[model samples]
Target: MTDASGRIALLRATIVVVAAGGLRALTYRAVAAEAGVSHGLVRHHFGTRDQLVAEAMEFAIDESLRGSNMLEQGLTASEFAAGIESLADRESALQSFQYELLLESRRRPELTPLAERHYGAYREAIERQLGRLGVADPALVDLIWFALDGLVFTQLVAPADPAPALARIRSLVESAAA
Candidate 1:
């Protein structure tokens, strides 16, 4: 594999390892095995475990935002988070990896910045969406974000059909603009 692709593969492998077995399960050997590469390659790419975990977290956050259409502009409230279910289903491991990292930050103080960045991305995206819909209040945006956050968290932890709840959220969002 090329250098860039190989590195991203390692990042993805890191996500899967953490998702399946949490942070403790992550090691150069584990990521190497998951990526089908040598442990030395994993080390060469990331240099340290902290770097590996941080890069993986950032990658997952970007990918999750892109896939969920959360950062895309011009979407109405009904259109916001339209493909969330599919994104969640397809990228459950990625989602779990992020949650693992977020929770891990509680124990490992060094991870706080990345954890904050992760949430900040979601908040900014929500702000943009709400802004387009003429809902400019930060407090209202935060409330909506919390509700949406809880919705996704519940779906991930419990595995449920989220269509009804999602539809309700969209309805509320649309009416909130009126």
Candidate 2:
């Protein structure tokens, strides 16, 4: 396969690994079986279980940012807020998987650096967008992040309709920017 194909295959495998949540703790054999790829292929690309987990997490965050690229495209404040709300709604599974990875990262400090890197990338993206809109309130961003984290937690546990909560959050963000 070409390099692009290999990268795509690895990313697809990472998606499966993220979705499998606790199965990653079992074995690469299990993940390969679930991803419908050979165990050798999984090992060849990742080298070790810790590397695989970290790459899986990074892939997830990249996929999510790609899914929510409106901010990069120069959306208005309200539009960015709405886009984020919609992205959260659409990427709820990815967010839940991230929380699972967070739990794993606690036990596997090797993964923490990668996790922190992905999170910092996300925060930087948000900060860049806010700066473009002349919204320099770090406290507001922190509050939004706190609220977003709480919403993700609640959604993972109870699986509510996110629209109402998201609209409220968007309104709050918009108000802050006003």
TM-scores of all models? 0.92, 0.84
lDDT of 1 by residue, 1-178 (tens): 8999999999999999999999999999999999999999998989999999989999999988888777778887667745434345768888899889889999999999999998899889878887897888898778767776777677688878878877766776777776
On residues 32-130, what C-alpha lDDT tens digit does candidate 2 reach at each position? Answer: 776677888777877887777677678777877778743485678788787765444677657766777777778988768876876676777777777
Q: How far is candidate 2 from the true structure (C-alpha RMSD, Å)?
A: 2.3
Question: In candidate 2, which residue pairs clash?
Answer: none
- Candidate with top TM-score is 1
Pairs that collide, model 1: none
Compared with the true structure, model 2 gives a TM-score of 0.84
C-alpha lDDT (0 to 100) for residue 78 of candidate 2: 88
How far out, in Å, is residue 14 in model 1? 0.3
